[model samples]
Target: MAATKKARQPAELEMIGGKSKRQRIWEVIRAQRDGLTCYALSRRSGVDDCTTKTYMQALERGGFIEQSNETVRIGDEKQYRLIKDNGLEAPRLTKDGQPVTQGRSQEQMWRTMRILGSDFNYQELAGLASTSEVTVSPAAARDYLKHLAHAGYVTVVAKGKGRGAGGVPNRYRFNLGRYTGPRPPMVQRTKSIYDPNVGKVVWQEEVSDDDL
Candidate 1:
């Protein structure tokens, strides 16, 4: 009788400290010398396209990875590589011991507030901030400004009447003197591309230490 062929087994995914699958995907990308395309990363991690994209976006926002300016021609997938080889994850606190904002949205708001140079209500602030090339809703802008005020990065320069017809909103001013928060990361814009998959123009930037 002919020898029966042995069934092939799938490679077992190694678990590090029982981390979630998303964390494992990050590890796989970190282990690679060259960056991996989203599709390739999904295949290696056994993750679906949507989940992989979500995790990648989270990592990118958290400043853990460097993304490529160009996407793969075949799949139109962006490539990403670990920013640091030493497994330096995003810090929850800044060097001054202040809590780090969860995402780039807050940072953009802070930058816009600094540019405003005077006390302004949330609506005016939001409208001016929106022109800074980052999408921020007026509601989100108001909430984040409140968060910053609570954190001592901003001051409630003036108060308004209760919510009523023709009621003026409280105006706020950026508190440059009291802020000990971390400086924004330096971003260097590179070439741009029009991703057909997303059907939008996208630009990539190299992030580095602001002091550098």
Candidate 2:
């Protein structure tokens, strides 16, 4: 009997622009119309979970990708999508050409400040941050507020006695005018999934962890 030849599998996608691992990941995300969870993306891109997460954080800080508020059922991983088309490229930079990054606590504080308006105390801000799924302690919130105040992003509006006698807490307001930094990109609520058979994206769904 003649020997049979085995079929060869297709080669994996190559990275473009001699880009770094993170950049390659971003390219993969850019190609997908539907957002992907960290796990799904890692599996498809052949990147490990830890590296994927690190790059994801960097991309998020650069306003290249936005993390959905929802989580996947398999591992509670958050979905990520490229920021909507605004002519701005990924790896967003600050005015001084610095990479824009924010810690989770700082992000929560900033978001709370923006949503709750300029008039709020650290306690209120902390509560709002917690409700928004970013847990922040009151002390930590106060520290973040102080840092913002020093950076001119926030201003002390008032001071009041704390819950305990002789204790004082400062009320701060967001200085929107002074803030000229890059803001988080607006995200779409739903995305379209590509169907290989049809050669086009045919289905749209609310960004969630549920099976498609």
- Residue by residue across 68-104, what tens digits does model 2's lDDT show? 7564577476877777533423453443334654345
Taking all chains together, each candidate's TM-score versus the true structure is 0.40, 0.41
Every candidate's lDDT: 0.58, 0.59
Clash pairs for candidate 1: none
Per-residue alpha-carbon lDDT of candidate 1 for residues 98-162, written as tens digits (9 for 90 to 100): 43555555566666777777888888876776644456677877766665554456788899787
* Per-candidate total of colliding backbone pairs: 0, 0
State the local distance difference test value for candidate 2: 0.59
Q: List the residue pairs that clash in candidate 2.
A: none
Provide the clash count, candidate 2.
0
